[model samples]
Target: MADSGQALARRLRQLRQQQWPDTTVRQPQLARALNVSVPLISSWENESTPKVPPVSRLQTYALIFCTRRSIDGDQLVPLDETELTTEESRLRDKLLHELLDLRTVALSRTPAPGSAPANPWQFDDGNRIVIVCARLPDELLTRMPYVRPEDPDYIELYTYADLDSLFELHGHIRAFNPGGEVRRRTAKELEPDDLTSHLVLLGGVDWNDLTSDVFQVLDLPVRQVNDWGGDEGPYFSHGDRRFSPQLADGRLREDVALFYRGPNPYNARRTLTICNGMYGRGTLGVVRALTDSNFRDRNTAWLHERFGAEEAYALLSKVRVVRGQVITPDWTLDGLRLVEWPD
Candidate 1:
């Protein structure tokens, strides 16, 4: 007798054949239709005992299949409740526990930080506050206040001031140097405009050796959220631009040079190095050489032709080279210059 998995697989194949009698359904097309990965469908086809999909995903698959069949306006018709219950029982008893065990083992293999106390927001007293804009990590989420994506409280704030300050605080929390100075300057800049508004710091900060000066410098009265702990949603990579740190072997250094050189090198050489020399080291020099005024201007036309303004902006933000120093453009460049060779 064929096992349940084989039966399910045969049934699925039959359903597909009945639905699309003339056409051969490809794995990718089926995966898309089912809202699942191609590997999953492949597994179902090959495995002796195929794992049943989660209830939510199964519902989606049923809906998609039903819609394709043009039955009941996008609703799955003729679903046997008894069959579903039996499958669900098998999945819960046989598959779920095993899958969960594997997942637990995988999670356990990774290094994790100390657990925060339950209810991190209990410290918030409507005084100093930090609002987090990024997704929170699961480990950190247990400590904080987080409304779900569909919740009415879910709000995405992206004003320059909010983002700038949030980014600055994020730097402080992550010990991001450039972000620290940016945070300080941001606090100073915003203080005058919003004096009455209590300082609300969002995102994590390094608590070790943290002094009142750090808080005072940023004008204290801050609220903080460390979403790195995982209370937030998924991490989204919105831009196509990629960033690679310069490795000591100098191969990565050459990579940076190639990016700057592009199609024409000699004609595009107007360079303005923006470095927090104390923090950024020599990476800014590399970026300046690559994105100098001449290169920027030339690239502008190319970028316009290739991508829209929003895309360009996203690319630029993603191209950022983060460093340890906290120097600004107004400061002298000598501090940040790498070893100078004899001219």
Candidate 2:
């Protein structure tokens, strides 16, 4: 992505210099002539910005360059002065803008922070945002069955419902860090230090090994039994409250999910997030909690009060799904617990 920006920047700068070899065309001068921000011109020349200028801005730059180079008194160069046809110019500008847009999308996936990291969801430019997805094993898939009747293949990378919520959440994050580098990796590919960046781990212990390792080692609220997914069935431990689909409760509750945010396990300086559940509905529940505006608002309110400015915390909740959609009305915030990382 940076390569594209660099190439474009090189071409733009080269044109400016070639058009006026004797004169020293400073960035400020070009910015003033084009009526754009000096910083924007600097970004284009230095390749510092993740995205190139928009098509309109590029056109304005060309006009300014042509006006600066004209021998006659006419400020604007006529279309006939250039050998290129009107259609050819339009086609070239369209392709250039498309390339810039593609570069912007690619950069948006990474963490791009300036100075300090304020929001856990947003990061600095050039930083990595690693989203670790779970790939379930065949044996584990056979053992832990999904409570949602419609759910299929627990071991799959991600279900459509999960992707729906994830895609929405990712889009929001991209808005803040358009130049950041985003990546997706499986549990098997992750190293200890890989957790040091802005990390988001999807799925639960039964499928996501990272979740299993964290809960087991950190003494977090969520717990897994040895006979988990067996006759006793999968469940999560939260102090005196134990949430499980097998608990035989009269309530219409069908699944449980966990959402955690905190410092990375390997490096406390970075951020990590966990969105997982005992079943597919539960996973979808976590995704909804992150993306759905109403759901996120309620959860954020609960978090602010419960955690009280803490940097790390966990959210344990349950959701009911009917016909492939999580019923938000039936959702409940079971537990909002703070995480005490080891010093």
Give the TM-score of each candidate.
Answer: 0.20, 0.51
Model 1 misplaced stretches (Cα beyond 4 Å): 69-343
The sequence of per-residue lDDT tens digits that candidate 1 reaches over residues 1-343 is: 1354454455555544564466455666667656668888766564365543443343344433443332334333434334345544444334323322222222223313542111111122232222222233335544544334455665333212224334433433233122221222222233432222222222123221112123233322222222334644112121332222343443222111111111111112111011111112222422332234323222332222223222101111112233433122111112222221110
- Runs in model 2 deviating more than 4 A are 1-120, 124-126, 138-168, 191-193, 226-229, 246-253, 329-343
Predictions: Cα RMSD each? 24.0, 16.8
True-structure lDDT of candidate 1: 0.31
Give the whole-model CA lDDT for all candidates, comma-separated: 0.31, 0.58
CA error at residue 249 for candidate 1, angstroms: 84
Please report the TM-score between candidate 2 and the true structure: 0.51
Summarize candidate 2's per-residue lDDT along 155-253 as a digit string, tens digits. Answer: 333422245545655776676579987766677788765777788877777667777787765656556553553776677765665667523344335
